[model samples]
Target: MGLLDNVKSKLSPAKDKVSHLAQKHEDKIQHGLDRTAHAVDKKTKGKYSDRIQSGTGKAKHAMDRLAHKDDDGGSMSPPPAGGATPPPPAS
Candidate 1:
């Protein structure tokens, strides 16, 4: 394999491990994100409230994607509990 392919092969296991952890602790991860966002907003005294909220929303959306949860309330469902076939993407 080429250099990039070699690096990707070596990192595959680590990536899988991280993905599993993220899926397993998705709720806790989301909670931590919210808590941190709240703390930052408080510290900033609402000056950047809008920006903070936007960033927080983006972060939560990313976490949801990582956890394979559908964002749009469309027919697409969340990943099955057993980690079988993943759900389809929303339109």
Candidate 2:
């Protein structure tokens, strides 16, 4: 396999583990994200309120993806047909 494929293979197990954990503790994780965002917003006295809110929203969206919350039957869906490229994974 190529270097990128090799690296992805090695990380697959860890990714699966993280996905499982995220699914199991989704509520708690979301709550923690909200609490942290609130604390940071308060500490900054609303100077970075917009940015903080945006970041928190992004984070929650990522967590939902990791948990596969959008998937039906708790499994990943197949990629679309017509050779359309899938979106890159979230950073």
The digit string of per-residue lDDT tens for model 2 on 66-87 reads 7884476555444323222122
For model 1, the run of ten residues with the poorest summed lDDT: 82-91
lDDT of 1 at 66: 56
The TM-score between candidate 1 and the true structure equals 0.67
RMSD of 1: 11.1
lDDT of 1: 0.64
Stretches of candidate 2 off by over 4 Å are 69-91
lDDT string, candidate 1, 13-86, tens digits? 88667767878998898778777777777777767767776677666665566556334542444433432212
- Model 2 scores a TM of 0.76
